[model samples]
Target: MAKEKIVLAYSGGLDTSVILKWLKETYDAEIIAFTADIGQKDELDGLEAKALSTGASKVYIDDLREEFARDFIYPMFQSGALYEGQYLLGTSIARPLIAKRMVEIARAEGATAIAHGATGKGNDQVRFELTAAALAPELGVIAPWRMDEFREQFPGRAEMIAYAEKHNIPVQASAAKPYSTDRNLLHISFESGMLEDPWFDPSATSNEEMYVLSVSPEEAPDQAEYVELEFEQGNCVGVNGEAMIPLEIMEKLNELGGKHGVGRVDMVENRFVGMKSRGVYETPGGTILFAAHRKMESLTMDREVMNLRDSLNARYSSLVYNGFWFAPERLALQALVTESQKNVSGTVRVKLYKGNVIGAGVKSHVSLYNPDIATMEADPTKAYNQNDATGFIRLNALRLKVASGVEQNAKK
Candidate 1:
């Protein structure tokens, strides 16, 4: 009889490392660890060696950064899917890509099961499992955190640390500095530990070391810098008049925005799993793109089209946040959003100063902003019809006047 094989999404982090070793010991299976490289800035360095040392049979580190930025990040950015009005969906967007790659590796390795370290309480477990279900339903999902044996064996971080120590696994677990963080190209998210307290005021110096993206706004640069972004069909293609790929564009904006101390958010949001959690995020490129894209839409998109898209933005955001990336509702809504952006070609000039993203200007070839029609200085006979407005206003306000008259009659 042969042992079953399972592919685990390995991050070389404490939790995933411990999970890797535990899966091998508990399942008596050949555990292959897979790590996706999504612009983590050398976080993947020596991950294969680390995974091997942590008891993985064979470690696979796939550089999926280009594909991630091109296929997933770009489209989501185009749709302007900001989770819960503040979160940039950084962790949300990265999960599917990672999960997809994990499934691919599983198939390649001929694994019967896939594994993840996402806690049972977080939205990431749903995101990872849903993606795996959509991509490779036949593969059994081995979630150790959800398993009674694993949960009882390692009740907390301390137990996990003890297990790692027994296995001679290298880990960063300690009594102090217990906050958890996830980082990728799109954004960095901080949660758990110290963030559990709603009244903790994340801005306080006690948590200053937790912020990876930037310092406080008070420490930001006093000078403002202007940058121009070029959009084609709602996707940002160029920055400051230089054409660049999706990933390059993001990198450029992130550098510029980070230099100026942009895109830091702190909020307590309702989780899909019936709990409120405090999350701090840094989305420099996303912040710039959102402001610039909205500004471009103002100049290029039709009034009714923009209004319709704006109405659905919240729904779309919710779907993405709640782990419905491959769901039909999100696909249908994305189709509508895509159709509306057909003429969203423009350039937006934005000023980034400290923590502010101010729109300086926007222009497009399909611009509906007619100075001739809108200018008060223009001749009324040319494009204006003052006479038509009298009947238009009267007809629109007739219901209000009738309601007022009825109130007066009732009073009399």
Candidate 2:
């Protein structure tokens, strides 16, 4: 009988690399290693060779940068979803996309199971498994970190390192840095290690080694910089009047935002598995986009509609954070979010200075801002009638007056 085929979500990192070898030895399965390239910069360098050398039967690396920004990031941004009112949902958002692609690969390769390196204690395991279950219910999901056999054999990173050494596997991990990191186009996140302490400040070092996408606010240039963003139906399409593709737009914004030290967040966030984790994130471009997008919406969106969407922002963000990206509820909410963006086309000017993304100006052709009626200066031919306010105030105040009278009667 042929050995079972397993598709592994390989990141070329120490954990996933060790998992790849362990899976082969324990399951006696053929491992097809998969890596999703979502703008991790130099992290993808030599990944293919490394996977192939580490007992992978085949190595697949796909560049999903454009799809990631256009499909996942933009729709989530449209909802203005922020996990726990702070995190950009960078790591949370990427999991679904990775899982979706892994499922497709599994089906194509006739694989029976998909494996991930997410630890049992962390949220990524839930994210990866939920997505796989939603997309491919028949496929078996394997989590090495959750397996007792795997844990007993390799209790910690030290044992894993020793195993790698014994098996002659090449790994870049070292005891010097005990933290884990996840990176993509939107942001780079650091957790564990010294960052595990909520009060620990990574910026104490002059190098600011923890940050990959932006500089420290104190180290940023003294002068502020301005940039213009153009949006069409709530999607950022151009930067500084230059029309660019989704990937190019992110690249440019990341550069500009990073130079000005924009988009750095540190917080202890609630994980879906009921634990608090301290994370430091650098989301330079995403910060600019979020600020500029909201500014543009202020001019173009209807008041009531904006309020309704804002009310659901927390629910929408929780759905994303909890690995429900492919859930029907999330899709339904996304549809409403998309519908709300139909009129959200405009330009927003932003000032970037010392980790701040400040909106300078916003304009839209379909703007509801009627300056003629709203002007403070008296206009003889203003559209708004001054006499209209008397009746409006009287009618609105009647309910309050009646309630007061009822209260006085009860007291008597």
Candidate 3:
């Protein structure tokens, strides 16, 4: 009988490289390492050679950038989903797509099980497993972090490093730089090292070499530069009036926003596991998208509808943050959000300078902003209903009048 095979999501990182080697030894089964290139352009370099050298029977590196941006990013963008008030839900949205593909590869390769390096404590574990549960219920999930045997053998990063050394498995990182980081096209997250301290100010030190995706805000251009974002059904289609594809639009916005230091956030956020964790994120294009989409909604969406959705946006964000992406309630909220964006087709001009995204103007074919009804210059005689104010005010003030009458009677 053929040995049972497990397809592991490999990143060629320390944990994953060690996991790849450990899985083969412990399971005594064929291990196929898979890497998804979802906009982690430079990070994917040498992944194939690294996986193979780390004791993988086979390696697959799939570039899911276009699909990532178009399918996952665009739909979340449509919902205007922000994990917190500040976070753009970057990591939350990428997991399902990657896991979906993982299941696909598992079936294609005849692998009985799929594995990931996500630790049991983090949101990634939930995201990956929930997606697997949703998409491929039949495939067994091998999460080494949750396994007692794996944890006993490799208690932490130090143990993993020792095991890697003992097994001759090559890892790009050492025990010195022990910070855990996840990167993709949408954004990159840094956590679990020197960052665990809540009071740790990432911006306090002038570590010019450490910053990526943007320059220091002090170095941003003095003058604000305006860019127009065009969207159709909430999916960004163009920048500054020139039509472009999804990835192209993102690249353009990142270039423009990063040049102006438009997207950089550091916060201590509540993790799904009831623990608060500090994170530093740079979401240049996503920042631009949020600004432009908000401006567009201000002009296009109905006041009550917008208010209703805005009220629920926090709950929606909490669901996404808490790893409820596959939940039915989230889907229902998403459907409502999608319905809200049907009229959210428009262009919004934003001024970016020194990390500030100011709304300059907004225009949409579906816009509810009627200049005729709003303009101060409009003729007062015909459209104005100044005479109706007396009855309107009297009716509105009845409750107050009744309360005042009762007070007056008591005083008398």
Question: By lDDT, who's the top model here?
Answer: 2
- Whole-model Cα lDDT of every candidate shown, in order: 0.86, 0.92, 0.83
Candidate ranking (lDDT, best to worst): 2, 1, 3
**1 versus 2: better TM-score goes to:** 2
Spell out the clash pairs found in candidate 1: none
Tell me which of candidates 2 and 3 scores higher on lDDT.
Answer: 2
Candidate 3 lDDT over 227-255, as tens digits, reads: 99998877788998899988888788888
**Relative to the unseen true structure, what is the C-alpha lDDT of residue 220 in candidate 1, on a scale of 0 to 100?**
74
lDDT by residue (118-216, candidate 2, tens digit) is 998888999999999999999999998888998999898889889889988888888667788899999999998878878787878643776788888
RMSD to the true structure for each prediction, in A, is 1.8, 1.5, 2.5
Estimate, for each residue in 67-172, the C-alpha lDDT of model 1 and write its tens digit: 8888888777767777778888988988988888889888998899999999999999999988888889999998888989989998888888888888888887
Task: Give the TM-score of each candidate.
Answer: 0.95, 0.97, 0.92
Q: Which stretches of candidate 2 lie over 4 Å from their true place?
A: 402-412
lDDT of 3: 0.83
